[model samples]
Target: MSNLTIVLIILVIYMALMVLIGLQGRKHSSNMQDFLTAGKQGTLLLVTGSYMGSHIGNGIVVGGAEYGATYGIGGMWYGVGAAISFYLFAIFMARVVYRNNYVTLSDLLEQRYGDKMTSIAVALLNAVSNIAVMAGQIMAGERLFQYIGLNPLAGAIATTTIVIIYSSLSGLWGVMMTDVIQVTVIVISVIATMIFIATQGGFSIMAQNLPATSFEMIPFDGETFIMMLGPTALFGLVSSTGFQRTVSCKKEKTAILAPVLGASLILLFVPLPVMIGMYGKALWPDAASGTIIFQVLFEAMPPLLAGLLIASICAAVMSTSDGILVTVTANIVSDIYHKHINPDADEKSLGRLSRISSVVIGIFALIIALQFSSLISLLSLSYTLITAGGLVMIVGAIFWKKATRQGALASFIAGVACVVINKMGVSLPYASVFPLIPSFLAYVIVSLMTQNKNAAAA
Candidate 1:
């Protein structure tokens, strides 16, 4: 078969397998817990694979490669930061979250704060932010199809339909299982592509050809460096997704190992695409840096190998979109539907609602993905929303015995409001500081003040 034909075949087979897995997972997921958290029976390897695969999606895959071209040796810090975030999760947050028995982060928050208002708000924003992420995945898949001389929109629609159909059927089990397969394909392909490029010129030639800024540790302005490393790290560590992964793990060791292993692999290879892009830039300076990966594989590499590499990129996007679909649906069904509308709803009814929610959320995300442009910008915004409300509420629940419902309520409202206002560009110019800082402070102050009142009454 031709290279294009090979790629098309791989995608068809892979997508077909995912749909089958989705159908099979339904057997295991007969209840809300089964659908949302796999009956809390996720094994160590399962947790590791799912968390690692989901976090290192298409953006990290292709985007890391793009950064490798520009950021040089230092750009690997992105994965480095991510690894650190997971490490912190394993040490402090994972066990606590798991012990709490909350299905979603919003579920935990609502219980502590005694408020549904913030949970409602969080569910809405989580769905919206996740759509932003799904859109980027769609865009990446589209770019790949474009290189093969197919319509970008058609590629996007096809990819989205497959993901949504499977996700609607399988829920979290399907997402986690499929992620392992996707991550394997992505890693193997990335390594193969990198080795090929390295052999063509070696690091010496690549370094000699690429610009100096591409290799520097602190590529951006001094302020940008601090912003990226400081609050960004905190935001990532404390967010709902990170906590959920930690809580989802079968054991603490699994939580620790998966992220470390995944992060290490990502750090080792993600820069390869950038190096490829750098080489492409040297060869075709006018080529858009964003398009460098697709352009290089299509034009430089032999057809058979290029098809394999492109399949890897598709794996990256699908792995992530499915996981996010599961997470968002869990929040809606557990935190919104079951919690407020019908606490006594049967497991069968909740399971059916979860499947329905998955499809509804998938469509909404596809629509938004069609509209957005920048992947990193949307990622930053989503993290901000989660950190602002989610981080503080989770921390308070675990650490502070004195943290009252009133205090939790205040923190939830103020943190979310501040995050939204900051994100909407309503604050002073350059006042768009990371939301975690202010949200953390509000949580601390409110909790302390309320604790003192309770003590006085005693």
Candidate 2:
């Protein structure tokens, strides 16, 4: 059989397994709460795997690889930023998330501000960010399809369809079960790929062919590193998917510990793909940066291993995609419909709505993937938006009891406005991150001014 044929066969089998797991997971997710939050009883293995899986999509795959191809080992700074966020989250917000029986981060906003506008704003902004991140994951799948000699559009469509199917069928249960398998497959593939490269002289060969700068841990200027790292670090504070995963665990300790473990694993795994990209740079210096990882995969591994890795990558990418879909669905069904329209809806009705919402969100994500071909570009924008007001408000909600609804509203407005204004005419270095300054100032200044407004109630 042709190499492409073999890869396709493996991919098909892997997809079939994912669907079957989703079907089986349906038994566990009979109700809205179970579907949305996995009944808030997820085991450490399952929760840790899900946490890691959801964080390791196009950001660490295609984006990281392209970074490596461009800046060598410095590409890992992106993943490093993510790791920093996870650790920071564990230290700062784990206790707060675990103590509260919240299904989403917006719920936290509601508790702190007690305003429907704040809650809805949080949910909607997060949903928008999730859509962009999901697009990045689908883009990764699209690239993998291109590598297999298939139509990239078809690959994007098929991948989205499959994720929506399984995700809508079983919700977070299916996502977590499949996530464990996907994480296992991905970890193994990464390790095996590294081993295969080692046998071919690995970094020694890479060093000989590439510049000495290729080996530098952080290849770029400090400003570039901060631009790459800041949003990702703050992202863990406001991420809807991360919030859902945090609440899904069986215990507070599990909720706190899982992200720590996941973050450490991510820190370790970040460099593997960077090295792979460097190897590809050594092999094909002129190839497109985004295509370098797959080029290295096909050239370095045996056909069977390559095929398995390809299938694993597809599943791994979808792990995050499906989680984002589920989070958005939660916002639709619980935060909007249930909260406003019919608070007494049964599990069956909510379940139906959840499925429909996930599919709808997936469709939107597919559209976004088509509009933005660059994984990091789409991701950077999403992360920037999430961190702008989202990060500042989350911090205030957690630490500053004096923070008021009006302050949150003002913070969000100023933060989002800064981003828009920056996009229009600003010419600063790392412009994407500059909005946070105004966001934080708005939060603190407005909250202090508005404290007496809440004092009447107190």
Candidate 3:
């Protein structure tokens, strides 16, 4: 069969499986909670699948490939950062938040901050950030199609439509189950590629073929190196849309186990891109770095194998896209609709709203993706906002009892203000310099000051 035919067949099979899973999940999804949280019955394996699968999107594949081409195998720093964040999640934040049994992170934010306005602000921030992240995934998928001689816009629409249909119909249960299958295929494809490259030349030949700087882990100059490494490592721990993973878990154990194992697998899988990047640099150094992985696969493999690699990228994009869609809908349904619009709404009504919200947000995101020229710019801006605001409040709620409502509110405001300023091209030493440190410090200071009042009163 032709490579394009093979690719079509693989996608058809993948979509068929997704639809089947969505249908089956419908049996268990009787209420908003069931639809959005799998009735809180997620196992450790499912949790791991959902967390890792949703995270391993076009960002890692496209951006990591680009980094690998420029920075050599040391580009594994992305996964390294993610793995450390997962470890942090397990020991510190995972169980604490999940055990509280909150349906959304905004739930906790509202509870701790005692400010309805602050909670609503967070929900809006999360929704906007999610759209930006989804846009990046669509952009990457478009680039993938361009590699295979298809129109990029058509590719984005096709991928986005498939994801929205499944997620909007079946919600988190559908997304999680499909994620298991998608992540497994991705793991298999990446591991097999890594093994092939290693067998072909091992590391020595690749090192000789590439620039010396590419092989060095610490090749970047001092200031720029710190700028890159610090954010990459801690970003996951601080500002991730982690509520989806936590809420889907059957219990706290699933939450902790999934992130740990999922992160470990991510680290193990990094060699795939690094190897592909090195091989592509050796053969097609002049190609756009983002296109290196696809070019290398087509050059070094048979048509069938190349199709399989394309399928893996498809799996990664779909898995991540569905998770973001579900989470964004969850926040809208659980945090806003039920809380503000109709506090007495029935389960059936809320479930219907959840489905509708998913479709609406997914379509909106698809529109943005089609219109935007710079995917990375959108992704970075989203992360900067989240890390500045949501990350501090969410993390503080888990670890600090003294973290009062006022404190979280102030810190959240600080983080958000910094992000806006940075977006406007104004540099602030603390806020725009990087999100984590200022946000972290602001949360601590505000929390402590608020606590002092209680102490004085007592």
Candidate 4:
């Protein structure tokens, strides 16, 4: 059989297996508590695995090559940002979030300010961010399909459908369990490529072929590095999936260690794809930026192995999508629908809504994937909006007891407004993070005023 045929066969089998696993996860997911977080029973291995799955997503495994191909060594920013996020969260957030017994970020923020409307607003914004991230993940399957001579749209539809089905059926436990399998495939793909490259002369040959500038950590400028890194760092801080991973852990030590260990693994694993993409640039010189690494890997692997790797790429990318999908679903069901829209929603009704929301969110994300083909760029836009508008509020909620609902709400408005304005026509350094200035100021100023007013009234 042709390689494409073999890959098609393997993909069919692999995707079926994923759906089966989700079915198994459904057994554990009887209600929102189990569906959303596996009932806080995640062990260290599962949490860390899911964290790795969520963070690595399309941003690194596939998009990393595209980024590294375009930015050279500077592509290291994503991994650096992730490592920083994990370390910071471990020290500042892990325990706090766990102690409070929060499910979504809105829950965490709501306690600080005591506003149901603010909770609803947070849920909506998070929905936007989560859906955008899901779109980025879905694009990975489009990339793989394009590589294999299939219709890109078909690939996108297929991937989105599978994720919606599986994530809806399985929930958090299923996501973590399937994550273990997907992560294994990622390791094999990376190690195999590294070994293949080493056999063919390794880093020495690659360095000689590439320009010296490719070795620099900051390949372009400080601003671009910050632009690339800052959004990820802030998103890491505020990410719903990251929050889910933390709160999923039952033990205090496990919660802390999972993200830390996962970050360490990410730090080590991220460089391989950057180097691989660089090597692709050194050789092909004119290959597409977003697909250089995949091409390189496919060229090195046998037909069967290549098929497996491609399937895994789909799994890896969708692995990220399901988490984002689940986050948005939770926002709709737990944060908005159950909490605000229908306070009387029983666990059974909420459970049905959760599944339906997953389907709706996945469809919306699929529409986005159809419009944009740049995986990393799409992800950047998602993070940019969230970082600009939501990051400040989350930080204030955690640190400043005086952070009132008015301040949190203002920060969301100003930060999001600034991002839209910046995107329209403004050209600025660190465009992704630039809006944070207005966001932070609004959050702090409005907060102080509101705090004083409330204090006086008391």
On lDDT, the leading prediction is 2
Model 1: ten consecutive residues of lowest lDDT = 428-437
TM-score between model 2 and native: 0.96
| Model 2, span 1-458: residue lDDT tens | 87777887998998888888888877767787787787776888998888778766567866788888888888888898888888888899888887887678778988889888988887888888888888888888788778767898998898899788778777787888888898888778888988989998977888888887887877788777777888888788887877788888888989899889989999989888778888888888898888788887777678888888778878878767888888888887789789977999988888778777877888899998988767776887888988886888888898987889988988898888877787788665676688888888888898899888789887
- Model 4 alpha-carbon miss at residue 100, Å: 0.9
Tell me how far the alpha carbon of residue 65 in candidate 2 is from the true structure, in angstroms, after superposition.
Answer: 2.1
lDDT of candidate 2 at residue 257, scale 0 to 100: 93
User: Global lDDT for candidate 4?
Assistant: 0.81
Ranking by TM-score: 2, 4, 3, 1
The C-alpha stretches of model 4 lying farther than 4 A from their native spots are: 202-205, 456-458
Candidate 4, residue 404: lDDT: 85
TM-score of each: 0.88, 0.96, 0.90, 0.96
Q: Output the better candidate (3/4) by lDDT.
A: 4
- Least well predicted 10-residue stretch by lDDT in candidate 3: 223-232
Of 3 and 4, which scores higher on TM-score? 4
Candidate 4's error at 182, in angstroms?
Answer: 1.3
Q: Give lDDT tens digits, candidate 3, residues 297-416.
A: 776756666666677677667767877887788778778878877899988787777767767887788788877654444555566666677777887776678887767778778778
Which is better, 1 or 2, measured by TM-score?
2
Q: Which of 2 and 4 is the better model by lDDT?
A: 2
Residue range 1-458, candidate 1, lDDT tens digits: 67667767876666676678778788756766666676555676666767667656665666655555555655455555555566666667666666775566677667766668767766766666677667767777766766677887787887787677766677677777777777777677767777877787756666677677876777776544543344345554555555556566677666556666655565665555556666776666666655667787777777666766676567657767877777787778777787788999987787678768767876776676667555544555555556566666677777777776656656667767876686576763332245556666777787787887767765
lDDT head-to-head 1 vs 2, winner: 2
